[model samples]
Target chain A: MAEQPPESARTLIEVVPALGEVAPLRPGDPVRVVIRFPLGHYRVPLYLRGKTGTVERLVTPAIDNEEEGFGRNAGDRRYYYRIVFPMTEIWTDYAGPPHDNLRIEVFETWLESARHA
Target chain B: MHEHGPGESRPHDEITETGPPDYFDVLETALEELLTERNLIRPGEVRHQIDVLDSRTPALGAKVIARAWVDAEFRARLLADGRGTCEELGITFYDDTGLIVLENTATVHNLVVCTLCSCYPRPVLGLPPDWYKQKPYRARAVVEPRALLAEFGTIIPDEVEIRVTDSTSALRFLVLPRRPEGTDDFTEEQLAALVTRDAMIGVVPVTAGKDGSGA
Candidate 1:
């Protein structure tokens, strides 16, 4: 009988970003952000897409996945960047009171300065 | 954007031009593909499971947790091993694996998120809220838990050290939120009335509403 070919094993592969270090953001400056997933990378959030928001404050500095695992030390504390967005801009046709905004803590690397369009 | 490349026109070309779907949509696709390829589950079965899971998230489990929070012995059994104790109340949980129950303390609160994937207590808690699956909430909750709680209308004093637990492993979470004020000697049904889905997730405090008030 002819020899049988070896069977290929099937597995799910998820690509993640390499971590990196970065500077803090100015009040109006955009801080780059990245989404870290145990499974894989993802876009930061739906509400923030194509919308300009302000940086409220900086919490901690930890890792950036782009350059390498910049802040992924097993025991390192992560820095969270707080960003604010007007609710009306996010939820289309929202008929709520004016000036109701949402503040979301996004890590660095998932954001870029929105050049006024 | 007409970003399509030469190979992009091919149905198999998912890497370029074709952008990814929304968060929940992506989850739905992944689950569908997984089941289809494995033949372990069918589309109809998946929908059925989703419906079943959604219907299970009423105040049932929350009521049980509330009762345990008030009763020392029941609470002890709940703390010792939730699986055995849950059986006493006809609420069993084993979404194909063993279960663990963690109570919420005065200073600490627990919220579960399957950062790696959507690992939830489907049998006990049912479908997760839309916000739970968002990347922003999942990523932020672990790093800045208290802030996330505030977004959900929960405000804990600065003195309380809020701990945000990420459920990235096989283990699941059940929050035994602090008993809301003003309802001592409340019946089980009343206590259960106070338990809300948001409370179980630690986003909102368990409030004993009108039903929970001693009549």
Candidate 2:
């Protein structure tokens, strides 16, 4: 239960941002999540570390999770993408249908080009 | 603050069955007290926020879904802009979090989960159910969605592809379940009554009988 102050001075409806400024990693591009674990609060799930996935769509500009978790203002805006991973890729013994997939919203900083790996 | 080693259980065995206050509970109270003491936030702001959340329920989401089911134009608007559409129905999302409405089609099913934490669309669907925040639901929803859906009695056809969306703090998701059959003559109010929080969450589908009985 989080409460934000009323936006009396603001516009009635906030404009939703469109997909803007495609970076090196575009939708459908293969990418790998960084394996490093930083201290303090983080949004990247431990299970996704070192996993590769395809970018489904660009979601929004990255509002640094670490900064926000620490009660600080959002830092450098990076592109966040909706990445989809095959269940088999995430789990070695995935017993479900082969077509099943998992999609997660990941920030750019946590990803790297999967061309080499 | 004391930090427990990895995989170490909390030393609550010696305490009473009720045990001590949760560690995170103590931390949250301390943080709130500090913020209030410094005048950074009002004394009762936290309680006020909790009250605001408690005031919300699945009925609000049911109203939105009912409107969409009856009105094609409203359904289009809801698919395009979820927050704006909700606002049109007098439901304002005060927070900056963006709401995305996922539609369930005949061949496709959508399930939402937050593997990292419980990040739900509070404005529309209200607070999440207790099971949604648990680790089993969070971990299994993305990995074995069909099996998970079966546990909820939502048996999807083998041909239908199940799509799982992992929600985050920045973006929240609400599943726009397909309109149930045998309800063409039912009023919008009746349709709303048929809609449940679980239906909106995509774990179950809304069903109604011709006699307006519960499904």
Candidate 3:
């Protein structure tokens, strides 16, 4: 039999408290993707670079993809967010209805305030 | 028992020597053997975990969907806490990855894809299909969700907005397909039978026959 999680595991809703240097990005905040070409394994996709999107939700505080990918103990973690962008904004030739959108989970380091962009 | 004499070839030996050894296969074997030799992990435990994974299928997800359809409160629970709610039906999520269920509605359609690596809701939906892990799906699902979905034979209407979610992190997503129109009178088991693996993946919708039989 598969081992059952303890009764305390019933609390499935993850409540990530603000701590450390976590960004103040909240749900519904418009953010622009940072244009960075870091040399190493990274989670941010190439297409999303410099694109603008709204934060959908705060997912969790996770170790940076660089550390996770390279098995290094960089001792750094960032708040991950689910960001939603219009499909039209993502692809220039996107031939879809105007309301179509794409949601991507991204780390805090890849995002910046879109207000000035 | 037939024994291979000197200079004699066996059928199994020929098959083994024909192809180059896969890199991942060699790595996995070496790792497993090393761990077992170091008493870090038992081979039996590894086999048991594999068996657990092998036993999981889309049927388990279908059962959860069926129950959610018949029971309103269960649906609420399922939407609120997908991982915990699945455990109510004896479906355990062994991995720490969290599951979020997205509902398909009249005005909205939901499609899931992993743009990076294949981060799937394997606990509820079993292993992802080959196409789901392919480059075409990972690339196209994000840029042109509607076109990608249409290729899977799911044509969303113009009025309905399609939302494509890229599971890029620890969070995995599953689409809770809208229940078929005529399944109100059907039993949960029959309803479950109508819920195909593709339906849960949001590539298709559930359908029921007029005679109360599932399609």
> Which number leads on lDDT?
3
Once fitted onto the true fold, the runs of candidate 3 whose alpha carbons sit more than 4 angstroms away are A1-23, A72-76, B1-27
lDDT (10s digit) by residue, model 1, range B1-215: 12222122424444455676467655656766677668786545654555565556756677668768678999998777766677687766646333456577775555655554565666667778778887888766644565677888887775554544445333456777788777777776777777777777768887766664633
**TM-score (all chains, Cα) for each model:** 0.50, 0.78, 0.84
Clashing pairs for predicted structure model 2, backbone only: none
Clashes of 3: 0
**True lDDT of residue B177, candidate 3:** 90
lDDT of 2 by residue, A1-117 (tens): 867657885554577544433466888899999999899777888888999999988876766677777776744566778898987888888766666677788888899989777
Candidate 3: tens digits of C-alpha lDDT, residues B1-215: 33332223444753475688667655766777788878898646676777778878999999998998899999999988888899999998888788888888899899888888898889988899999899999888887777778898889998999998888888888788999886677898998898888888788888787677785
Q: What does candidate 3's lDDT look like per residue over A1-117, in tens digits?
A: 998789987654586644534568999899999999988688888989999999988886877876788776456567898999998888888888889998888888888999766
Ranked by DockQ from best down, the candidates are 3, 2, 1
lDDT of all predictions: 0.59, 0.82, 0.83
For chain B alone, what TM-score does every candidate structure achieve against the true structure? 0.72, 0.84, 0.87
For residue B45, model 1's alpha carbon misses the true position, in angstroms, by: 5.5
Worst lDDT window (10 residues) for model 1 chain B? B1-10
**lDDT (tens digit, per residue) of candidate 2 on B16-77:** 77767778756876787788788898866776677678767899999999999999999999
TM-score of 1: 0.50
lDDT of 1 by residue, A1-117 (tens): 976555565333484433433344656664433333333443245435555567865644644332233345353333446566554555566433334444455655566766443
Worst 10 residues of 2 chain A by lDDT: A15-24
